[model samples]
Target: MSSSRSRRVEYDRFIPFRSAMDMDYARFALTRPSRPQRDGSRESPSSVAYQKLLDDCILKNRSRILAFKTAPEAPASKLPQFDEPIRPQKKQQRRIPKEPERVLVIRGLLDDNVLNLLDWGSNNVLAIGLEDAVYLWDAANESTKLLQPAEDRGPITCIRWSPDCAVLAVAYGNSDLALIDPATGHVVDGMEDENQAPVLSLAWRSNSILTVGRFDGTVVDYDFRKDDMFICFYNGHRRGVCSLKWSGLSGRYLASGGHDKLVHIWDACMPVSRHRPRQRQWLHRISSHTSIVKAVDWCPTRSNLLASGGGCNDHCVKFWNTINGACLNSIDAGSEVCALLWDKNKSELLTSHGSPNNQLTLWNYPSMTRVAEVSGHSSRVLSLAGSPLGGVVASAAADETVRLGLLQHRYTSDPKIELEKWCQMGYNADTF
Candidate 1:
């Protein structure tokens, strides 16, 4: 039986990739088809044909494969050996964050007193503080001087500088107004008066001064050129009047907000008879704040839009339509607002809280949502202003610092350098 099994085994194969020791593993087997005779006698021609077809198919597939079972062996030779295995090298990488072309900038110092109110006149600004002193700042030159009049009997409550920056109107917590020439740091004249209550807000129309206060709850018009005497006092607000602003675009309309939680619009003009300074007839009385309205400002671009803020005893800043007194939008700041500024270029609303928190919060006007908040001040923030480019914002607080920065960078290039060169050439021509 062993002899018969040995004769039956077929071997024409190659070994698998393993150590060459044990050779009894299964190997490839090659089979040859049995040829048929021309005379088919008791055997089947169909089986022979089928076997030949299967063998041909197997040979065809084997030829297409890349790897083979059998190959000629290489000659033995000595080669260099690497002690370390081939390892892939990793490369170092660096990632950088993108920076803005123009950054939002803010910097400032503390004020000696809790600034009651703030005002901007042309390239200058005024801050009315606790000592009946009105501090004027030259915005372009970054200089400041205190305007404390000889007759200042009470703390300055509010200030308004003329649009042309020719004269500065000062109002004390008590009834009085001082017109000062910042150029000479002297009182202009006829501004000393003690008959009215504290002037809460100051405004200017054509060459005259308009002031609002609690004495009569009326709008008082003062003509400093004609005389120190009052021109017209029109009763408008039922309660104390606290805020007033002129339309920078038209210079024809005046806006005032009062403790009555209403905003009054006045047509600023001289009456036909000139008896009253075109009486402020209270065109629109807007009511949105539940408590006293603290401040109000007319848009510089459009004469029909007004922005107002109130210490939240009402909790929000509101934009109102000047003609219809309709509330357009409200931003919830969650703090008592002491100051608010409208950045014309970026359309951002900058608000400062008086108490509870001394943070300055910036809001996107279009979205009516808070965008960024600065929490560096330890005291209440009283005033805010944005640069023309709208890249930087300046805020004044109970702490005494005036901050300046880029609102937006037109470019890293200096805009003034070229202008300076042109000016030098012009100077040389004039000298010749």
Candidate 2:
């Protein structure tokens, strides 16, 4: 076979061009003039056919090589033009329902520092300070107004608002006792006796008020309309009384706890005709706490239940039954229980701690179990109160910051899962 005709098969299997030099050289060699055709003789038909075949093979092979090398020149199909679909972030909201705004008002910032506070019914909050001033806090608007008399005595240590929320009784230094109207800020009556050193606590039941002094461990009861001031004296505590609480369920009965580590229950019932009301009888005294009792409160829902804390530096919380004055249980809070409060619903016991560390602990009431420990204050925690209608809790500290927080509880509903599935379709947790 002729050399040119035989080369056609080789062109069909052309090698791919790898470099620019190889490609250019191959094209140049194919186009260059063939060797002097056999002494310039006129080529025969077979030679012409062979020469045409060789040229055609060279052209086809060169085209295939060039096509292989330059194939990338054409613009790529440009990957489907996709924009990563934007994902929307989910907004988080509180789990509980929104509640009304209830505020705590600062009545008077006393110079000697305010030590005690009492809520007179649902309308008024009583605060006593070292400036010989008695402050009546308007609970509705969270504001404070003074209610001191013209003959203002010494700094008040104890204050009690009548069950009717109409009058206030103040117990102060120099063994003085006075009754003042909270609304008009006027003193209706005043009495002084040298029976006790200084009154530390005051409690009111019906129309009579209960007062306890540091000089004697006496719980003195006094009536407003009586000519002579004297009620039955509770001498069960060997040391001065520190705190007192009257049961709202049975206004005629009360509870008192003091430094003697004893809690006494009393019953004050007098005939409606008695001009000078008689004394209340001491029903029982339960000695349970190892140290001084700082504060005592009757459970709002449970008629016979009471809670106490303070001075028990080792174990700071305790629950008891007022019926028999028997302690139900105790909890070790690792500090002095400066203040103890039962929530508005009486389902929780909030305890405040003093120096070294400031903390607020929420305990399941009566059961004596802790539910949560809140820590954000740099100073001692002084007071704690919860909203009546909401899950919000307010705590006041010596640090001057009143913290407000929601009591968070986890709840699951069937709708939540269905909604999440509909929203998340093909996505997962990692997509967030």
Candidate 3:
């Protein structure tokens, strides 16, 4: 059986790569007539007959593909023609075009407030918490809040405005959060931390849903439009949450950084019932920082990209691909990262620092280069907020001043700048 199997294999006669020639030859060989000669005599055909058959096969197989091809200009054809190519667009500038124009500077508030409590609303209003009181600074008319927080409502720890500007959510040191009508200064609705922990951070996913982070690392979300209010909670951090930001392609992802040296990424699209809501697990728990993780923000354009910074012990700014929780890049920012903000229309990032530097550093994303650094505060910057218009930034610091900078990166016609010039002149007349 082995000998017969060995003999069954047929050796190839066709040349490598030129399989078409092999196919041509097989067609000619198979078509030859098998003549049964009389008297069991087998004989070769006449040379003329063979030549006649060869001629017939050649004529049958002939086609344009078998014809010769040659370049008529290169000793053959003319040179190929090409249309004029379009030039690529110029790259966006890495640095802020000019130094930040000091727009509106609010001076002389008492020091000692939560470091993660400055937010600029889409309604052109800025909310800032300064020790025991919440202040709303209206940028449109240069008028301060006629509806201010009462002095006895404990110390205001966090202030966030809804996307629609319908209400402002203020969290007190006593773990109570109130949603107040921005125009009327009336507390319309409120919630409290389940554990009675101090609410340190707040992020709004939509005008109706508010995400809260507490001193005990508890994270919860509430839909203000509903009766039950409580939607879901996230757990992972062992210490107080320091910052919270809601960003993603669908704006359903919640990124929270805490004092436990952890960053928890949660998703609200997982679905939670209002009446029987329970603990919702975190999507990703990033433990890349050696110290407390504080400053955190999502890339405005890239949904899966997130950036976070560490406290003084680890002063490193790290970028993460939130889709897979991978550390994409890291920068050793020489000072503590107190807060972070990203330009909405550009790939630029601004970070507020603490300790010796106390400087605000602007960076070009992906490239991770320091574009500009401005020393605007006497002490560490407490928090940062970028205007909804995409060019200005508001930073509050321990210096008890809120400085608005018209980054003026690429906007030649930003109305915020015209408004800034007006506020710069009138800022000193009023105080908060």
Candidate with the greatest lDDT versus the true structure = 3
Better candidate by TM-score, 2 or 3: 3
Q: What stretches of model 1 exceed 4 Å from their correct place?
A: 1-116, 124-132, 139-141, 212-216, 269-278, 386-392, 399-432
Write candidate 3's Cα lDDT for 175-219 as tens digits. Answer: 788989987889999975545888888888888888888888888
**Per-residue lDDT of candidate 2, residues 1-432 (tens digit):** 556654534455755556533556467777876756758977788677655655554333343324345344434342321234435658765342222122233433232212344344434353434345755544345456766544545666666666666667776767787777777877778677676577777776566654554546767666556776565565566777767777877775677777777777776553332443344446777776777776677777788788877563445577776666676787778887767777655487778786667777778755657777777766676555444433445555655445545554322345455333323333221100
Q: Candidates 1 and 2: which is better by TM-score?
A: 1
The TM-score measured for candidate 3 stands at: 0.72
List where candidate 3 sits over 4 angstroms from the true fold: 1-100, 103-114, 192-195, 270-277, 412-430
- The ten-residue window of minimal lDDT in model 2 covers 423-432
Q: Model 1, range 172-284, lDDT digits (tens) per residue?
A: 65566677787887777545446656666667776555554553467777766664457666556887677666787887778777778877777655343446545546667
**Candidate 2 Cα misplacement greater than 4 A, ranges:** 1-115, 118-121, 124-130, 148-152, 209-214, 268-281, 382-432
Pairs clashing within candidate 2: 232-279
Clashing pairs in 3: 71-76, 71-77, 72-76, 72-77, 73-76, 73-77
Native-referenced Cα lDDT, model 1: 0.59
TM-score winner between 1 and 3, please give it: 3
On a 0 to 100 scale, what is the lDDT of residue 387 in model 3? 77
